[model samples]
Target: MKIRISKATIVDERHPDNGKKRDILIENGKITKIAASIKTEVDKVIESEGLCVSIGWMDMRANFRDPGDEQKEDLESGLKAAANGGFTAVALMPSTNPPIDNKGAVEYLLNRAKSGKVQVVPIGTISKKRAGESLAEMYDMYRAGAKAFSDDKESISESGLLHRALLYTKNFDATVIHFPYDATLIPNGQINEGVQSTLLGLKGIPAIAEEMMVARDLTLLEYTNGRLHLGPVSSAMSIKRIASAKKDGLRITCETTAAHIAYSENELENFDTNFKVLPPLRSEQNRKELIKLLKSGKIDVISSDHSPEDEEHKKLEFDYANFGMASIESFFPVLYTAVGSSMDLAKLVATFSINPRRILDLEIPEIKEGVRANLTLFSISEKTVFEKMNLKTKGYNVAEIGKELNGKVLAIFS
Candidate 1:
C-alpha cells in the first residue's frame, strides 16, 4: 500500500504545489498521485489539521562524532535526530576524532552514513588533521563526495596557507568554508565581549575578532577569486562586511546559526555553557540586526551549527566548560518562533531547505506528483515545548529546553 497524505498544504515556491492543498499518494518512495481527493487505502496516512509540507530541509553544518567520540553521537542517532527535526539532508562537519581530511575519511563517512532517511554530505578539512598546516588533498576528498572544505571551529591563521587553499580549490569549483577566529586577539575569551562579559567577570571574545578574520578572508577572496562560504557568523558588523563584499563582486557567501539569531549575550548572564558558542553570541542589537539581515537575504542560509558536546565536557564549571550546542533537533521550532513574524515563512523555510542544497550544488526536492517522497511534514502555528521526552540529541543545550516554540514537525518521508 502507498502512503497517503490528504489536505496537506504545500509551501515550496519552486513547484506548482506552492500554495495548494491536495491529496498526495506516495508509493515505492515516489509520489504517484496528487489531487484534491483520492479514494485509495494506504499502509500509512499523514493527514493532520493545518499541516504543511515542503522539500526536505538541509543543515549545512552539523557534527556526528563517529569513528571517535561516539559518546556524543553516532551516525544512526544523528540521523534519527535530524529526521525528527525535519531535515532530510545534512552536511557533516569534519571535526570528528580522526577528522575527515583525506579521501579515505570521506569515503568512510559516506559509507557509514549510507542510509536511515537522511543524506549526509561531508565537509573536508582545509588542512590535514585540521592542524592549519599543509593543505589536505582537496581534489581527492571532492572525488570522495565532499561538497565543501573547512577547518571547522578553527580559522586558518596563516594567510599563506589560506591563500593556497582558496587558489587551489578554485580549479575544480569547490567551495571553501572558513570559521573566523583570531586566536591571538581573544586568547582566553569565554563569551561575547560586551557589558555582559564585563558584568559577569568572565573572559570575552570581542566582535572585532570575528570581523577581522572575515575581513581578511574577504580580502583574500578578492585577490584569489575563489569561492568562499563564511559560516556561523554572529556579529552585525560582519554581516555588513560580507554584504559589501558580495556587492563588490567577490565570490562569497555566508551563513548564521539559529542559536545566534534566537539568543543574545543576555542568555549567558547565568553562566550557562550551552549558550557558549564560537563566534560567541553577541548583544541584543546584533541579534535584532541578524534577523533583519536574514530577512534582507544578506545571510544565504540558516544552519543549526549543530555541534554536540557530551556531558563530561558540557557539565563543567563555566570557565572549564566546552563550547557548543546540540541544536539540529531544535532548529525548526526554535527558529520559527524567534523570527516567524519577522521573516517570510516561505523564505525562512527555504533557508533550511533549498538554499543549503543550492549552495552545496545538490538537487533540491519539489513537492509535485511523479517526484520522490522527499518532504518534511510541518506546521508553523502549532505550539511546542521541548522537554526531556522530546529532546532527541545526545546533548541538550539549555536555550531551547523550556522555550515555547511556534512550529511542529510531524514527520519526514523520503
Candidate 2:
C-alpha cells in the first residue's frame, strides 16, 4: 500500500534523526523519501489535517482468547480491535483455556495472528499450564515464534520454578515478562486494599503484595543478568523499587496500563466489578508517580493490558467477578487524558510506539520518505462519549465507560 502523505507532521518517535513536521513519500511499504513537498508519482495522496502521524503503536500486553476460548475473543476480532485501537503490533498473552505452554499451541497462534493485518506475537507461558509448578517448553516455544515468556495475568511464583524459567529464557536471550504479583496475599481480593475496600465491605488486594514480588524479581534479575520486562507494575512502592533497580544498572524495563494512570481504587466504592483488575488500582499518589515515571523514561512502555471477559463474568457481584478490563478501544483515549494536555506529542508517541517496538527487538521503519505506510493517525483533541457502540471488544468492562475523553483513533495503516 504505497501512498504519499502530503502536509503531514512526521512524528517518528524512534528516529529523532528525522526532524518532525515533513511531507513523506511511502513507496512499496518502505519510506522512500522524507522532504518538503516532494514531487513524486503515487497511487494516492493523503491530506493530513490536525493529525500526528507516527510509526505504528505496539501494545506489550493484551489477552485475545482465541483457539479454545473464541467465544470470548477470536484472533480476527481481536486484531480488528487492535487495529481500531491504533496498534500495529500486539503481544498476545498466554492465559487461554489450554494455555500456550507447548510448541504446537505457540505455532498455531503465531500462524493465526500472521493471517491478520497486525503483527500478533504470542507470549509463551512461563510455567507449565500456568500452574506455577513447572516450567513450560521455552526453547520449543521460542522456536515457534513466541517473542517473550509470561504466565499472562499472574506471576509464576514458586521461587525455584521462576528462577529456573528466568535462567532458561536467558539461554534463549529472550526477556521474561513477569506480572509482578504474589498470589498468596491476593486470595479472593476484589479491589485495591484501602479505605474504599473497608467502606464497600470488599476484599482488598494489598499494594505490598505487588511491591514485595517486584522486589524479589529485581534481585533475581540482577543475579541472572537477563532481559526482564516487569509488566503492569500497579503500585507506588513497586514503582520506587523498579526505579531504584534501573538506577543500579539492571537490564530491566517495566510498563503500566492506561487505566492505572487514569483511575484509582476509589472507583470501586460503588462495588462496580468493571473497575476491578488484577494487581488492582492504587492511590492517587501512585497514579501520579506512574505518570511521572512514564514522562521521565523510567517506565519503558504503556499498554492497553486489554484483558476481555464476557458479560457473564463482568455483570456479577464484585467478589464473583473476574479481574480484567477491555481497554483495546479505550487505550489511546485514556492516554490522552493522562498527559496529552501537558506533555509534548513526541514523548507520548515514544511511550506508545517506539519503546515497545524496541523492547521486542522488532524492526521499526521511520515515518520518512519511501517507507511503507505502517502508521497510526489520531487527534488528541477529538472528544467522544465511550459506550457499547464505541467499544469493539466483546467485554464492556471499563473504569471510564461513560466518561468523556479527549482523543480518538482515526485509522491504522499496516
Model 1 residue 221 distance off true place after TM-score fit, in angstroms: 0.5
**Tens-digit lDDT string for candidate 2 (171-289):** 77887888888878867777788888889888788888888899889888888887889978888678778888888898888888888988888777788887888778888888888
Candidate lDDT values, in order = 0.88, 0.80
Per-residue alpha-carbon lDDT of candidate 1 for residues 1-414, written as tens digits (9 for 90 to 100): 588887888888676667788888999899998888888989988877778888899999998888698888888888888998889999999998898999999999888778578999999999999999899999999999999999999889999999999999999998999998797996978998899999999988999988999999999999999999998899888989999999999888899999988889999888888898887999999999999999998988889988888878888889888888899988888788789866666778888899889888899888777888899998876877888577677775545787778889988987
Q: Give the TM-score of candidate 2.
A: 0.94
> Global CA lDDT of candidate 2, please?
0.80
Give the deviation of candidate 1 from the true structure as CA RMSD.
Answer: 1.4
TM-score: which candidate is best? 1
lDDT of 1 at 365: 84
